[model samples]
Structures are given as structure tokens and as C-alpha cells.
Target: MERKHFLKSLLVGAMSAPALLAACGKDDETVAPSTDSTSSGSCTVAPTETEGPFPTKVPASYVRSNIVDGKTGHPMTVKITIKNANNSCAVLSGALVDIWHCDAEGNYSEYGGTGMQATNYQSVHFLRGRQITDANGLVTFTSIFPGWYSGRATHIHVHIYSASGTSLKVTQIAFPEGTGSAVAAVNGYAKGMNGYTYNASDNVFSDGVTQELATVTGSTSAGFELAITLNVAV
Candidate 1:
């Protein structure tokens, strides 16, 4: 946001998360055009997400899991607003974001097959897709709470796209502790699931504090709001 578009890795395990992003190279932030119409200033107009060290192990085949990624799909109702740190108009309408995550039991659908135990088959492309922000730089979609799987912790992957159609696969987001419902269904239903802690130990969220990192919102009256800041390169 400082120069052209704001983007940077922002980390090292030895240092703090915010400090890391500060250390990483960041692009200048861009604003939305007045003629457009999505909502207000929110994510950039670039498509795709800023990819990162986040794993890219897509399976040969996968089933739709409990959650679907991106800004479209089954009506899950998610309002994604791309704005600057001040919550002003970051206005990047038409930007594409590539999002992906796990199901409640933490199993991935696409990367498995007959070779591995069916993690339940999917009816469609759940947890994978691209979201294009509206003219106002806001994009909303439907999706469910993603499940947790092995090795990796609970989190979401996102990549950014620039106006030039360049992809900045660098930024990512995560859910903070005391977030989401502490469900018994996942641990009980899945063989390997149980006692999934919401600590910062997980690889995806070890850094614990960055715009890419997620923090939980909402309350007993509503579901959780996994809020995060995505510095887009547009």
C-alpha cells in the first residue's frame, strides 16, 4: 500500500509475525475506480491470491469436503471487503482470489483416490475456486467452516492478482485462538480428529500476527467471523 500495491512475506520463525511482514518486501496499495460498483474500498482488483510457503499439494482427485474455498459456490454467505489498515477504501474491484482449505475433519478431497481411504467423496469442487470482487472491491460467497486435517494446522490459502494479470501467490490467512466453535462432531466423527487446539503452534499460523493471519469474530448470537487483512498487489 505504500508504493504501488502492498504485499510482503512479512516473516521469519525467529522474529515476530508483524515484524516479519515489515521485513518482507511489500508492494504499493491501489485504489478502486469510481465508475465501478461492488461496495467500497476492499481488496484490490487483481485476481488470484498472493501464494506463499503454503503447501500446494493438490491431489489427483478429491471430493467436496465440509467447506468450499473462494467467493462463490454453495450459499455459505461470506462478505469479503478489501480495505486498507484504516478500513478505508482499498478499492480493488475485479481482483481474483484463489482460496483453499480443509474440511471439519481436516481431510483434503482432491489429492486422494482409491489408493487412499476415501475421505468421503465430494459432489463438486469444494474448497477450491476463484473469487472476483465487485466494482466496489467487495466480494461475497457461500462456504462452511473448513475441517482440520493432519500435519498442517487450520488455515486458509490465498493468492493475489495484479491489474497486469500478474499473480502474487504470497499472502495467506489463518484463524486465531478461541475462534470458531469447539465442536465435538469432528473429533468424534473422524478417526484421527480430537483435541484440535487453537494455538499458534500450527505451521500456517505459528507467526500469529499478520494481515494474512485471521482473527475470530461473531458471538453466541452468530457464527464466527474469521477476519484478516490481505495486502493486495494491484
Candidate 2:
């Protein structure tokens, strides 16, 4: 369904989802440190990742902070801080950050592909958006918890651009196994826990998800907060 129709169909459901979250008292928890231990100096830059099969250029109108205006699924806040890997990881302000992910049903918005089961959503643009980094080199988006699809673990695509709108780096982020499993159990997730894939088994993260896995806090009932720092040669 296109975004307009998609939102219309779910308007009532969207209005009530927040109340469910509040009733459950799901609050933010601090993200665990990466499993792979490394000092700041020893850590290499965040791995360069594939844009996957559904990459799209977010239109200016879609370049807003909240990407989940009328979308379903548990709420999540994703914050990315851009940094210069060569400059003692100094924050890089003014970078353009674009992010996209699938809805709770494992269907993406704005791009159509064989990987995505919903062909009707080819032209639909829902969970797709971008934002500019602030003085703290941070860009945040309000999105819903993403659903799982075959052949891949739960993940989100990210693209970084210079303040001039020039591309700087492209990569992706994944949720911890515990969080993925927890979120899958929520009301709207169709895939359920059985549909989840751990970082070791996922085709993209199997090589290693040490840096790609985001630190997630919060719960299924209330929502989740995800934070990941992107190290680039900005």
C-alpha cells in the first residue's frame, strides 16, 4: 500500500498503539557495550556495509527527523553520531544522515524488489527518511521497531553525507539478539520469535557484527531506543 493509504488504514491502530506502550511501562534501558572489547584507539572504523537490495534517495520532503509518523510497530529512537576516525574520533557536525528500514511486516517503503514480499509498496514511501547532524554530530530519527525477513537478520540501512550533500559513507546497523527476539513478540510483529536470525547466522553480519550491532534499551511494550556511533573519515 502507498503511504497515504497505508496511513489511512492504520490511523485508528496508530492512535492506540501508544496507549499500549504506556500501559506496559516499557522504559529505556542503557545499551550494552559491544561484545568485542577494544579500546577507543585500537578500534578500527565502523565496517563499510552494503546498502542492501533496496536503496533509495530520500526526497527532501522525506528528510525529516521522525520517520514513523503513522507507521505501526513499537516506537524506537535511533541516534547516530558521525565522527572522524583519524581525528581521535572527534565529532563531525553537519553531516547528512539517511536511514531506511522495513515496517513490522518485513516490507520496506519507497523501493520494490524481489526480496521485499510487498510489491504493492514499490512506490510507497513510509519508513524512509533523513536528517542533518547537529552541533553534537548527532542525527536522530523516530522509527518503529523493524521486522525480519528471510536471509537477513533485523537491520537498518544508513548513509552518511557531507554537509554539502556529498556522500561520505554507506553502512548498516543491527539489533542485539535479545532485543530482536523481544521486539518480535510484540502485538504487530508478524514474524514472531521464530523468524529471528542471530548475528552469527545472518548473511550480512556473519562475518562479524561487533561494530554494526546497535546498543538497544527499552522494551517491547513501551518501545526501544537505539544508539550507534559511526566512525568515518569525515
Query: For each candidate, what TM-score against the reference?
Result: 0.55, 0.76
Off by over 4 Å in 1: 1-76, 83-89, 114-124, 179-199, 219-224
Clash number for candidate 1: 58
How far residue 41's Cα lies from its native spot in candidate 2, in Å, is 3.8
Candidate 2 stretches with Cα past 4 Å from truth are 1-39, 59-61, 113-116, 179-188
Candidate no. 1 TM-score: 0.55
lDDT of 1 by residue, 94-141 (tens): 666556655555544444443222454443355655566667666554
Candidate 1 at 168: error in angstroms?
A: 2.2
TM value for model 2: 0.76
Candidate 2 lDDT over 42-108, as tens digits, reads: 4345666656456665455678988885878888999998876656666888888889988888777
Alpha carbon RMSD to native, model 2: 12.2
